[model samples]
Target: MVGYSALMERAEEATYAGFERLKRDLIEPSLSRHEGRLIKTTGDGALAEFASPLAAVRCAVEIQDGLISGRHGFKMRIGINLGDVIVGTDGELFGDGINIAVRLEGLADQGGILISEKVLNEVEGKLDVGFEDRGEQQLKNIARPVRAYAVRSGADSPLTERIGVAPALPDKLSIAVLPFQNMSGDPEQEYFADGMVEEITTALSRFKWLFVIARNSSFTFKGKAIDIKDVGRRLGVRYVLEGSVRKASGKVRIAGQLIDAVTDAHVWADTFERDLSDIFLLQDEITTAVVGAILPKMLRAQIVTATRRRPENLTAYDLQLRAMYQYSLATRKGLAEAIRLANRALELDPRFGFVAALASLFHMVKVILGFATDPQFDRKEAIRFLRWASSVDDGDPQTLATTAMVSAFMVGDYESSIEMIDRAVALNPNSHWVWLDRGWVYHTAGVPEEAIRSFELAMRMSPLDPMLDRLCVGMGMALIELSRFDEAIAAGKKALRHNPSFSATYWCLASAFAHLGRGAEAREAAARLLELDPAFTISAWIARGGQSNAQLAIEGLRKAGLPE
Candidate 1:
C-alpha cells in the first residue's frame, strides 16, 4: 500500500487486471498448494500467511519467478513474516506480524522478496532461488527492530535489483539547449539565424559531462512561446537554454537565457549584438561563457562522471555541418546526397572523425532498414570505416561512439559498445548522435532509465530532425519499461506528428493503447502497423534493438491482435 499511489498513478486498470489474472492463475494456486492463506494484495506488493514459514518463502519465490517470465513491467514485492496475529471481524487480519510483513515488504526491492529472520530460519536452503543478506533493518511504529534478508527471483541478480545507476540519479545536473528562435524581421533570414544557433549548439555539444539536450528535439518547440517547467517535464531536463536572433543591417542581435527550467528562474541572461563578421567569435564566446558559468555551480558529484572522452580534431566536422543541411531537408534524395557528401569527405580524409563515423552510420542504416541491396556489404563497410577511424584517433569521442553503435547492432558486443560510447561522449560533450546511440545501447542492455535520457537528449539535438519518429518511439518504449504507459502514449503520439509513415510509432501507439485497455484504439493502431509492415510481429520486435523492450512491445501488440 505504501507505493500503491505511484503504481496506480503510472499503470492503467488493464495493467492491474493483467496482474490480477496472474495472481489468480499462478500466485493463488501456488499459495494454496503450499497452504498459505491470502491476506491481501496491494498495487505492487502482496501479503499472505502460511502455516509454515518455509511455505511462505517458497510461495513468494515461485510467484516472483512466474511473474518475471512475462514482460510488461507488472512486477511486485513480497514479504513474509511468522508471528502472532489478531483477526478482525470484517474478514480482515491484524497483528504485529502483519505490521512486520508490511514493513519488510516496504524494504524489499522491486521484483524482489524479503523475509523476517523468523521466516528466514525456516526457509533456509529449502528453495532453489538465491538470497542475499541485507542485514538488520529498523522501522518506526513497530515495537522492536526487525532482521530482514532479500530474495532474488533467479533471473535478476541481488546486486542488479538493488544497485542504482550513478550517472542518471536525480542529483545529476542536466540542461537542454533549445533551438534559438528566429525573430529577424526578414523571413528569409530564418535559416541564417538558426544556422548560427546550430553552430553554437554544435560547438557546445563537444562537452561530454554537460547534459546538452538534442538540437532536433529541443527545437521542436521553436517559433512558439512555452512554459519552462512544461519543457522540463516533457524533456526531463533540469535547465533550459533559450535565445532569439534578430538580424538586421548586416548585423545580428542575439539574446540568450540560461533558465533553471524546474524553478523557472533565470540563472544567466546575456544579449550580444555584433556584426556578421563576428558571428564565429560570438558563437565561441557564448559557448565558453555558458560552460564557464554553469561548471562551478554544478554539484560536486557530477564533476566526476564515470567517463571522460572527446575528439581532438574538428576538420571533419565541417563536412558533417554541410551534410546536416541536406539531411535536415530529409527528402530521400537529400539524405542520400548527404550520405554521398559524407562518404566523399571520408574518402579524402579517411580518419576525419565525424565524417567517417557518420559514413559508417549511413551504411549501418542501409543494413538495418534494408536501404541497400546487400546488407552484408553495408555492414562490412560500416565495420571497415569504424575500424579505420578508430585507428586514427581512438581517443576521439565521436569515433568511439560510432564504433560502439555499429558493434552493438552488427557485432553484438553490447558491453564494449557501451564502453566506447561512454568514452566518445566524454570527449565530445555536444555529440547528439553519441547520446542517441548511447540510449539505444542502454535499451539493448536492458537499462530503461539511461535509455530514456539518451532519447531525450536526442530530441534536444535535432528539434527539426525528420528522424525523430524513431527516437520518440524508442523513448516511448523506455517509458513503458519504467511502467509509465500514459507518458509512453504521449511520446508515441509525438512521433506520429512528425512522420505518419513511421511503423514504430504505430507499434508504440498499439502497445500504449492496449496496455491502457483502450482496446479499440489499440486494434486500430495494430492494424495500421500490419498494413505498413506486413512482416511486423513479436519476432520482428525482438530482432530490432532491445530484447526486453521488444518483449513488452510484443505483449502490447499481441494483446491488440498481432500474433506472437
Candidate 2:
C-alpha cells in the first residue's frame, strides 16, 4: 500500500477503518480468486505466494484494477518473483526469492507492480498486461543486479509499440555490447563503466569478419531492461555482451558474459580484477581479453549452427562457415570438401571476397599436400582466385591475409605477399588468423625466425583456438630451418596431440627426427606419413615450388627414406 503513513496523519481513524474494509472486500478476495495464499502482511503491504506466476500476475492486476475502479482512497504496490522459497517453521516465507520480491515492491512505482525477470519470463506472453522494462536494478541486500519489469494494464502499451517485426541478421557474425551496469554505488564510476564498453566495442570492430552494431544503436538500451531475443531482433545481431563493473577500496572488478541473443544461451563469461592505477590501461587489457576470448567462441557457435542447417538452406555465409570447418580438419578429403563448398558459396554470391580467398587457400593447400591431380591447374586456380579476391575486397583483413599466403606459396611473390600481410596486420593486429597467415608467409619466404615469432604471437592471441595444429606445424617447420631439431620434434609432437590425423605433423616429425640421426623414429614417422598420403613424394613436394624456402626439410625427408 502507498501513502499509508501520510493518509494516517490526515485521518488516522478513517484510514485504519478504510484499510480493514479494503483488505476484506478487495485484496483477500482477489488473492483467493487467483489461487494466491496470503503469507503475511506489514502494516501497509502484504507478502503473498502463488503456484503459478501467471496466476500471481493476474491477481495483482485484478487487485490494482479493483482499487482504481472502486475509488479506494489509497493504492497498493506489488512485486512478484518466481523461485524456490524456504518455508519456515511458523509458515513464514524466507530466501533470496522472497527478499528479491520485497526489494522489488519497494522500488515499484507508487501504484504500479514490478516483477523479476524470472516472473516476467513465465507470465509475459500469457498475460494481457504489457511490461515496461525497468532495467537492471541494484536491489538492497541483493548480491547481483536483478532485471525488473513494470506491469502496465492498457491497450496502448510500450510493449505493443516497441516489439515490431525484427530485422534480418547480417551474413557475417554480428554483435552488440550493451552498456555495463555500475555496481560501484557511486555515480562517478558510471563513466568508467561506459568507457569499458566503448573500449571493447572499438576493439571488436577491428575484426572485419564481425558486424558490430554502432555505439549509438547499442546505447539506446543503456538503462532499459532488455530481452536478449528482442534486442537481437531489433539490432539484427547474433551475440550480445553484457556485464557489470564494481569498484571498491583500491581495486576494480569487471565481469562480462557473452550470450547468443537468439537462443539466450551463455557462450562465454569471465571476470577481471585489476588495480585502480591506470584506468585506460585497464580498459585496454580488459578489452583485449574479452575480444580475444569471444571471437573463437562465436566462431565455434557459428560453425555448429551451420553444421546443423540443411544443405539446401545454406546461404553464402553458411557455405563459408562449413568450408572453414572442413579446412580445420586438415586432411585431403577435408581440403576437397572445403574447395567444393567455397566454389558453391561463390556461385551464391560471386562478390564474396572471403570465400574467393578461401578458395585460393584450399587450392594452395591441395598443392602443398600433393593432393592436386594437375599441379599446374591447381596453381593457376589458386592465382586466379587470389587475384579475384584482392580485386573484389582488398580492404578486408581476412581476405588480404589469406591471399598473401597464396601469393607466397603458389605464386612465389615473397615481396608482394609480405606487403599484403603487413597491411593486414596493421588493419587488425588482434586477429589470430592474420598472424597465423603471416607466419606461413614468412616461413615460405625463408624468414624462419620471424615466422616462429609470428606463430608464437598467434598462439598467445588465441590460446584455445581449434586451429592450433596449424600454428604448431608452422613453428616446427621453422625450427627445422634453424637446425633446432629437438625443438622441431617437440613442436611436431604438440601438433600431433592437437590433431593426430594431420599429415603435416608426421612430415614435420619425420624431417626433424631424420636430421637428428634418429633413424628408427624417422622411419616410423615416414611410414605414418605414407599411410596418410600414399602419393606424397619428395619430387612432387619440391615441384610445388613452396619448398624452395624449406630446403633443409626436403633434405631431411630424403634422409628419412621417403619416396623421391
Candidate 3:
C-alpha cells in the first residue's frame, strides 16, 4: 500500500480496472487460504485478523511475493502484533494491539513486513523467514517502548548469518548518531536536519574519552527504517542516538534520545525548541547541550558495566577502568592499588599509552602526597614511564596531558609543560582531563588566573566526574595564590568532601587558614595533614620542585608552625 497515492495520481481507467482485478484475483484468495477474516479495507490497504500469529505472518509473506512476482506496479508494507483486542459492534478493532501494528506499518520500509516482539517469539522457529531485531522503538502514541523485528523472506538472509557473531565493542565509551528524521514535511529542510547531526557528531568527537563513529559511516542508514542493535553491531558501538527535527512557523524543534544498544535501555532523552533566527548558533547551542548532558550519563553507564565484569575476564581496558576508579579515592592505599592495576594493564598491552601515562602519574602522586617509601626511586620511575608513554603515542591527548602535569610538578619545566598542555587542549578541546591538566600546569607556571579559568572550564564540562576533587584542589591552589584565603578554604573543604584522604586538600586548607590568621584552625588542619602523611615537612615539600611558584603557600605553612 506504500505507493497507492502515487498510483492514484497517475492512474488511467485501465490502471484502476487492473488494480481491482489484482485485489479480486490475488489478495482476497490469499486471505481465504490462510483463514484470515478480512475486517475492513481502505483505498490503499486492508486490515485482517487471524487465529494464529503464524498464519498471519505466512499470509503477509505470500502476498508480498505474489505482488512482486506478478509484475504488480506497487508494493505493500505490513505490520503484525499479538495482543488483546477490543472488537466494537461494527466489527472494528479498537485497542493498543491495533494501534501498535498501525504504527509499525508506518515505520516499515516499502515491501517489508515488521512484527512485534510478541509475534516474533511465537512464530520465530516455526516460520521459514528470518527476523532481524530492530531493538526497542518508541512508536507514535505508544506509552512505552516496543521491541520490533523486520521480517526477511528467506533463510539465507544476512541477518541469519549474523545471528551468532557481531563486532565487539571498544574498550571506551562509543556511540553512533544516526541522521535525524526531517519531520518538517518540506524536502528542502533535509539539509538542516543533516547539518544538525553532523554538528553533533563533530562536537562529540572532541571528547578524547569517547569513540565516535565517523559521519560517513553513520549516514549510510539515512532515510531507512533501521534496527538500533544492528547499527550498533555494524559500527562496533555501544550506544546509538536518533531523533527528529521539525522546522515550522519561524521556529525549530529537535528531539533526541540515547539508547544502550546492548540492552535496549533508554539512557537519556531531551527536546529543544527554539526560534530559528540564527541557524548556526542554534546548532551550536544544541550540540553543546546534548554533549554536556550525555557524557556524565554515559560515564556512569560505563562504570556500571565495567564493575559487573568478572575479574578473570578483565580486558586491558577493563583494568584501566578499575585503576581509574581506585585513583579517584586519592588515598595512599588507593594509589598503591591503582598502580598495581595499571601495571597489570600494561602487561596485557605493552603499548597502551593511557595506562602507561597513568602509571607515571601514580608514581608522581606518591612523591606529592608524601607516600613514597623512596622518593628518589619513585621520581626516576615516574620520568622513565613518562618517556615510554610519549614514545608509544605522543598524539594521544590523555597521555600528553598527564605527561605535561608530571613535567611541570616533578621536573619543574614550566615552559615545555605549558606548551605540551596547550597542544593537548588544542587536540581535544572537549576533554575535561586535558583542561584539568592545563589548570595544574598553569598554576605551577605562576599564572593563577588562567589556572582558575581552566579549572572552571573542566568543572563545567564534567561536573559529575569522580576525579572532581582534583579540579577543586587546583582551584583552591590558584585562589590561595591570588590572596583569596576564604575562597581557597571553601574550595579545599569541597575537595575534602569529594576525597577526604587527599593530602593536597589538607595542604590547601592549612595554608588558607593560616593566611586568614585562624591559628587554632590552621594548627588543626596541619595536624590532620600530619596524620595522613607522617613524613610531611616544609623542607620536603619545597624540595619536590615547583615550590618557587607557591611562595605564598610556603609562607603560610611557616606561619602555621609546620616543621621546616
Candidate 4:
C-alpha cells in the first residue's frame, strides 16, 4: 500500500491481483502457521505487528517465495514493528520501533526484504539468512537513528558488486587503506578518523600512471585482523597506511606506519593527536605526510622499473599524456577533483587547452552520472569547458575530438559526437575510448550496425575488458526495436555469458521476448529485470542519469507491456 509506485511499475493489474491472492492463500495461512495476526494491508505495501520478531521474518521470507513462484509480477517490500504502534488520527501508528520499521522498509529493495537491527538481534542464530550491515544510516525525522542491515533474499547472498576485478597487477600498484582502528574507546565519534583515510586514498588515485585500488577495496579493513606486509602483497601496492585513533575524556592520540612492500621497511611514519574539533586540520597533515612523503617515491621507482625506458616520443605526445590523465577519473568524486586540479593548472597557464579539454572529459561523465543536481547547469559547464578548449588549441586533436563528442552525444547534436570521434580517431588511431564513445553515440541514435562496428574496433584495441558487454546490451535492444527478435536474444545471451550478474542483460532479454510475442517468457524476463533493478522505470532512469540514448529500448519495453 505504501509502495504503490514500485508495485505498479512491475504490473498494474497483476500487482493488485497478487495482493488479494496472497492475502487469501499464503498470508492468512502463514498467520495460522505462526500463531500471528494480520495487522493490515493498504494496497501495495503491508504493515503488521508480530508476537515475535522471529516469526515476522519467517513469514516475510515465505511471502516472497509465494509471490515469485506464483509468477506474480508484483514484488512486495516488508517491514515489521516489534513494539507498540499507537493509533493516529490518520489511522497510522506513531512509536519508536514502529517508526523505525517504516524507515527500514524504505531501505529494502522494491521486491526484496530489509529488517531493522532490533529484528535482526532478536532473530539472530534463529534464521538461516545472511546480513550486510548498511551501517548507521542518518534518516529523516528520527530521534535515535537505527542501525540497519540488508538480509540476503534467500539462502544464498548476492555477490557484492565491484568493478573490474584487479587482474594480476603485473607490477601494478593497487592498494587499499583499511579504516584506521579507532582505539579511541568511544565508537560514537569514529567518523572523523575513518573519513581522513578515505581522502588520502582518493588523492592517490589522481596519479593516472598508477592504478590506485578503489576505496571500497581498502575500507574492508575498517576493524579486523591484517598483517601489513601481507596486505601490501595482496593489494599489489608497494606501500600501506595502517594507523589507530585513541581518545580520552581530555585528549586524543594517533599513530600510523607506512611500510614498503618489497623491502618491508618503514618508509614513512607519523603520529598526531589533537582536540577532537581540530581533527579536520589534523587529517591534512596526515595526507600530506603520506602522499607528499611516499607515493611519489613509489611512482618514481615503478617508472625506473617499467619496460619502456621513457615516454614514446614524449615531444609529440604531450597533449596525449595530459589528456589521458584527465580522462581516467570519470566518476563524480574523480570529476570534481579533476576539475579542481584542472582549474588550478589552468590558473598557472591561462592557455591550458589540454587541461580545458580534460575538464570537458570529466564534466561529460558528470552530466551522465547525475552528478550535478541541475542537469542543464552541468551541461553548461561541460559545454563551456569544451568550447574553451577548442577555441584555444585548434591543433590539439584530443581537445577537438572530446569537444565534438560532448557536443553530439550529451547536447543531442548527434552529428558532433560522431564528428569529433572521427576526427580524434584520425589523429590518434590508438585511442580506444574514443571508439567506445562513438559506439555509444550511434547506439543512442538507434543506428545498430554502425555502433556495433565502432564497438568492435574498441574491443580489438582493448581485448581484455568487458566493453563488449555494453555494446551487446545496447545493440541487442536496438535489434529488438528493429523487430529482430532472434538476433536480439542471441546477443543478450552473449552479454550474460560475459557477465552473468549484469542487470542490463535482463533488460535486453525482456526486449527480445516482448518483440517476439512470447508473453510468458516476456513476463518472466520482466520479472528478472525487476529482480535486477526494481525502480527501473523509464522516467526514473532518465532522471537518475540522462538515458536520452536508450530511448528506443525504453520505447520497445513500454510497448512490450512494461507496466507504467
Candidate that scores best on TM-score:
2
Which residue pairs collide, candidate 4? 1-43, 1-44, 1-45, 408-413, 408-417
Q: Among these predicted structures, which one has the highest lDDT?
A: 2
Return the lDDT, model 4, position 511. 66
Give the alpha carbon lDDT tens digit for every residue of 1-564 in model 1: 235566776776866776676665556555644445566765555667665786577567656655555343566777778899887754467978889888887788877778888887886775545678888788768867888888764353432222221213122356667777778767887876666666655554444223444454466687777999888766667777778888888777878877776578776666767777776676655554444444333322122221121323223333455565555443445557668878766765665555676667676655444345565677788788777767554655656777788777777778888888888777665555667788877877778899898887766655544467767887888787777889999999998888786666787889888989999999999898777666666764555433543556667877788867
Runs of candidate 1 with Cα error greater than 4 angstroms are 1-338, 370-372, 457-467, 534-537, 544-549
Which regions of candidate 4 fall more than 4 Å away from where they truly are? 1-355, 369-372, 466-474, 477-481, 485-510, 517-536, 540-551, 559-564
**Where is the poorest 10-residue window by lDDT in model 1?**
300-309
Off by over 4 Å in 3: 1-165, 181-190, 206-209, 220-230, 243-256, 269-289
Which pairs of residues collide in candidate 3? 1-76
Assess candidate 1 and give its lDDT.
0.66
| TM-score of model 1 vs. true structure | 0.44
Q: Of the candidates numbered 3 and 4, which has the greater TM-score value?
A: 3
Ranking by lDDT: 2, 3, 1, 4
Per-residue lDDT for 1-564 in model 3, tens only? 876767777875656676776675456655644546677887778888876798688668767766665656767899999999998977678899999988888888787889999999898776545778899989988999999999985543332223223556767889989999999999999999999997887767655456776565577799898988888887779999999999999999999999998888899998989999999989977786677667777877887787789999898878888887778777788889999999999999887787889999999988888778888998988898899888665766778999999999888899999999999988767677888999999999999999999998888777777777889988998999999999999999999888887888888999999999999999999999898888889999977666679888988998888889
TM-scores for every candidate against the unseen true structure = 0.44, 0.68, 0.66, 0.37
Candidate 4's displacement at residue 262, Å, is 15
